[model samples]
Target: MINQLSWKVGGQQGEGIESTGEIFSIALNRLGYYLYGYRHFSSRIKGGHTNNKIRVSTTQTLSVSDDLDILVAFDQETIDVNYKELHDKGIIIADAKFNPQRPEDTNAKLYAVPFTDIATELGTSLMKNMVAVGASCAVLNLDIEVFKDVVQEIFGRKGEQVVQKNMDAIKAGYDYMKEELGDQVGAMQLEKGDGKKRLFMIGNDAIALGALAGGCRFMAAYPITPASEIMEYLIKKLPTVGGTVIQTEDEIAACTMAIGANYGGIRAMTASAGPGLSLKMEAIGLAGITETPVVIVDTQRGGPSTGLPTKQEQSDLMAMIYGTHGEIPKIVMAPSTVEEAFYDAAEAFNLAEEYQCPVILLTDLQLSLGKQTVEPLDYSKVEIRRGKLVTEDLPATDSYFKRYEVTEDGISPRVIPGMKGGIHHVTGVEHDETGKPSESAANRIAQMDKRMRKIKNVRFKTPVHKNVKHEQADLLIVGFNSTRGVIEEAMTRLEQDGIKVNHAHVRLIHPFPTNEMLPLIQSAKKVVVVENNATGQLANIMKMNVGHIDKIKSILKYDGNPFLPHEIHSQCKELF
Candidate 1:
């Protein structure tokens, strides 16, 4: 049996709902508890309702459940809105002033803690979230020392006075919970893991680190919602590693500058969200036509335009596949988790260089902001695949350097601008295999075929779909990007109910793993395709490639929210 606990903190957007959940997660992590957290809020700053959900367990957790184990309502609206979601045996901690009417049959324990009254009495409402944190600890029999340590770690740099006041507020709430909730609270202990571990990191930071590891020396980007964090992280970390991160004036400029840097012989990258990606499409085509090795990371958010800047969605699948005006062969890939993001970024750079093409790392808001702990990366094992640029040992010959020399593997030797006697012309018009402007129909078709063939060649060399529990299941669930963790968790739950299931996560999106995936899907009795996009892009692609649409099931969502394990389990049950 799996033991699960979920907490919801609801209040105005800026009233520390997100901070309260974050602090709880930090404390829980210290206790060796695995956690899954999700946040929801209006796009406004002041009055709209905001909620943060946190799921914690002694065992690993991947998704936040819909049911609440504990509900901390900061205002009357919160109590009114979320009381129905509380479990029958759950607990509700709320302000005393707003007495909510509870059903007679409701089994949830209710405690009125006077949160605002206590904060007002303490002479500052800013400590309200800390009060809630302390109260939660008291009622759950959690270690107060953990909360204290987190406080110090979070606010120690601010000053002594701020720390003291927050601690005082915490103590006040703790005292109140002790007096009211009494010994009914339960104790939770966790088993310690083996000493080998990795520092926790978010997906955006992982992507940035991976790019650095891949020898990306220059990055240019314009600030956009979900993708902005990638730039923020790279800007601070790149300088120390002898790299540069520039904030360009616009998305077009950012992409162009990255292209320029790539042309100058450095591995360069740029990142943006949906709107910015649209703006950079022409430049993306430019990179494609010129066969410059450049990486573009698009951290997708909900949009056709700026539909939802701060929410999660997978609507950009088609955009990444066919965004440019003309037919341009570009490699597109997605990483399923924070750890995968690091490796995928490095691999993306390598693919761009190997194929002399632009590569897109497709990520979404869920992966961009979600946090997780993973095994420490073995940097020694990392292989940097630089392009065919000539270094110290190689010399330019008297014959003119052909930028697009036809080779067996469809990859040409690349010589950058500074290399002596290696200067060559590149243009957007149809070009022959020798990289010159051409209008000949045969040359155009050959050029297009050559570009497409390069990606096809990479499909064989790229990593295949990752399958979990491959040999022991009849039902196969396939997913990509951030849907990986939740689907894995769902498969575990389904197994408990005597339903065997396996999972195949595709990391490379374009020029997909047709050879491996076809056989895997064929082996399964039923195939369930899960994605955050509404149209089930991956499922459709699988059908187009393998010709087995009849056996595949699609579980698609586009609500600007991610699927919980319970939801996926329910869908599987219905299908069975």
Candidate 2:
């Protein structure tokens, strides 16, 4: 019995390839199988190669496998580009119309089927994806009732006749596969689990839900790839909760609008990728100087300047942490899992409000766009904490309130706009206690210290070190963001091979967590920083925080793909 397997579908853009993978994954998830899915596509909309890969396992998996166990190819180009990634005994289901041939070097088997022809005969060519799904289910010996139920839910709104026709197409595909291939196709049967339900979502959806759960009432954004889905999701769901979403003219407008909404006493956020973040930098600096608490999500993509818009990278580490002009104490939080992405979003608002400073949530395309089977988040545990909010009645005064008042912890009680005794200056320029422009040297030093001091006072309890191995590890691996899963998996495999390796994953990037990280790195015999950027951005940040920069080795990947666990293991093997 197969405990795990990987299935993939490849075809031209807009051909329902994604839908096919989704249907298969949902059915597998219903049977309590863990899933990790990824998609590869181009910048163009149509007539280009696109594929969806889903890995199913009885055990929890968050990273993609290096080889495919089954591949469904819609065209000859699909086989040409993908056959090398298939395992030795892998099976390829190709469309008979394409007449696909296996590569000369591979030992995998290829079976041709009339996927499109059968669907067209059933009244709609769109059912072709369902046909592929049905054939795959037959091959895996999966109960067809689950697939039929999912189809009914998805297509029931269209009409009864449409749903019936699709069901006929599924039967045709399944019968064809069974009759032609016989017992050979049913050789690999996946073992079923305890059938406990789990939530399946991408990181963006989790963040959007977390925002709603955290009481975020406003969002403004200019649409951009990868990051646009966060805004799009909020647009549909926010109105139901009495929240508002606006598509601003540009990223600058988005950032400023979110800041303005926050000034009016609401939790507001804006999201964008690398290019949009660059446009929002000046506005972010304004939020910093004015001490407006707002959350900005940077769903990072490959870039020097729109470098690879749809690709994944952890390259924004330096840009997110140090990109803004002038000195500002901003918090940067990176969530490693889809579930963590939700909690991180909720915590981001709390941190921003507590310190009255902007918080940047740094996420990569892999974590932002990739789908995973995550456990349901406990909403009761989600604490809504708005720090330093003064709700008591303060009598109106002619002199404006002390908005930026320097106190013991450098955090002054904050009042919203139009509130009594709360009308104060809101500007990009540095201001004094009464919220007026000031050039006094003492005033400048005191204000700077006050704003800077709030970083440590953040209510967010950040872990300085995690995933540390006991019994004196042989090496230490340090990474952030999407690399967490693969790095942790690699550490496990290395341990099995008698290598004692520990890992330190930093959730809070800004204050750098110097005290907790310094001793860990100092004690390790060897240290490696794995990130997606070409230059070792995380390593440099570690150097700046701790003095032993030279001791840290850097393993980086910038080719717009995430690191596979085996790749991490192979790279670490060379180090030994």
> Which candidate has the highest TM-score of all?
2
Quickly count the clashes in candidate 2: 1
lDDT for model 1: 0.80
Which pairs of residues clash in candidate 1, taking residues 3 or more apart in a chain or in different chains?
none
Q: RMSD of candidate 1 to the true fold?
A: 2.6
TM-score of predicted structure 1? 0.93
lDDT, model 2, position 498: 84
Candidate 1, run of 10 with poorest lDDT: 187-196
Q: Write the per-residue lDDT of candidate 2 for residues 520-544, one digit (tens) a residue.
A: 8877878899999988988999998
Off by over 4 Å in 2: 462-465
RMSD of each: 2.6, 1.3
The C-alpha stretches of model 1 lying farther than 4 A from their native spots are: 1-4, 97-106, 187-198, 393-399, 459-465, 468-473
